[model samples]
Target: MNEHQRRLLTAAGLTELRFDAPMSECCTLRAGGTAAALIDVQSIEELRRLLALLTDEEIKFLVIGRGSNLLVTDSGYSGAIIRLKGECNALAVQERGPDFALVKAGAGCALGKLVSWCGGQGLAGLEFLAGIPGSVGGAVRMNAGAWGQETGALLFAIELVDKDGRIRQISVDALRLSYRNLALADGELGSSILTAAWFRLTADEPEQIRSRCAAYLERRKGKQPAGAASAGSFFKNPPGDFAGRLIEAAGLKGASCGAAMISPVHGNFLVNTGDATAADILALAEQVQAEVFARFGIRLEPEVKIIRDESCQ
Candidate 1:
């Protein structure tokens, strides 16, 4: 560990700190290597203090949610990992209009749980996100969507803490949401930390909303593999085309690279067939992308967020 990490450990008074906390323990894929340091913040104040300290020490760090839709490198992250699992889980409903309600959710709130809660309360507009597996903050960051709807469409505003730990609110219009991208601009160190989001929803019959969510869940079950360690969809669907169809057409289904196989059930999902590493999944993804490009001349883009050393190779 570096000097900054050592100082953080001493300041936090944490004895359970691991030199290399295994990446597999924190991600949905259950793959990847260790992080330089892992710290769990359990409150807003704690998160704020930690962020301020990191900034003062000039230590690079990342804020992680539930770790869904992410892939870490086998070489590992050489910076501090700030986990927001227990700290930002607040969720509540606020009145907007007679027939409309504003759903206020913390960044760490489970996306699926929020969807289910809204659906059970007869709230519409979140049904399309019924099967997405990630935290509310991640969904907002990625503009996560399904079945012709996106999280950005219903979002009223988002609360964020900038690099210097200053809190600010940004409206939906400022979020330049397009496809799987959000307003969180790249290239800026410690750009912003999503705190909470407010979504507008319309009231409907509870049963009707539940029925829709159930149907979407059923559809996902039929299309996605169950009981497997996979990071959801591997690639984003190209415009007017599907990634699954392209991979299947390229005959890359069931292709394996060191126990990481393109799931036969769904061509776009790469599954860890027990003991698969981040290298295996990445290799398979590269091969699939190459083959798909070779056959159809359409480049496939990954939906999974890869966090690792870009300078590795």
Candidate 2:
């Protein structure tokens, strides 16, 4: 780390710092270079200070969630990676009406845990998140969805630290939402770090909600690859067609480059068989994209967030 990096930490009073934290360990794909630092922020005040310093210094950074839907390059990130924890993962539920209830969750709350919590609380409308391996913040940022439901649909409001380090509460109606994307109405995309979210759910039988959640998980396990190191659903579905179907039609299933391979069970998954590098995964994805475009005339967009070290460029 340079002077700016050291200064950022010292000035912010952040303690949980890991220098040169390996992206291979942080990301679900299990590959990539080391980050300059990974800081586990413990409170909103800490985050505000750190974010302000980061902005003042013009440092590039990522406010990571569960790191499930990210792919960092082998050259690694040159800036800090901030992960919310401690009080940032708190959960609270309140009865709003006869059938309506409001659930407040910290951005760091695990999607699976939130789904389970909702089921235990007899809260419906979150069963679609049963098996998603990420945090609420990531889901809301990407508008993550499965089985015909998206996270944006259940959101009432969200609290986030803006680029200038001002925390603001924005309603769902004030945002521009679409397939796998949630953009700020008046700001640039990714200009804030989500701290918490408010979800409005309807009451239901706990047993029934649990059963529905279980069924979704079971269906997900049956359809998607299991126990493989993969960034889930690598490509977004083009209009009127699925990326997986396109990859399959292009005969790219089970294709390998180094230790990286397209998952045989699900064409959308780019898997690390064992020791695949970030380069291997990226190369395979590009190949898949080329082939799919050549055969179908539709370019598949990536759903997974790809982070390249700009310094290397």
Q: Top model by TM-score, which number? A: 2
TM-scores, each model vs. reference: 0.93, 0.96
> Tens-digit lDDT track for model 1 on 240-283?
99999999999998999998999999999999989999999999
Name the lDDT of candidate 2: 0.89
Which portions of model 1 miss their true places by more than 4 Å? Answer: 13-19, 184-190, 310-313
On lDDT, the leading prediction is 2
The TM-score obtained by model 1 is 0.93
Q: What does each candidate score in C-alpha RMSD?
A: 2.2, 1.4
Backbone collisions counted per model: 0, 0
- lDDT value, residue 38 of candidate 1: 85
Q: Rate the local accuracy (lDDT) of all candidates.
A: 0.84, 0.89
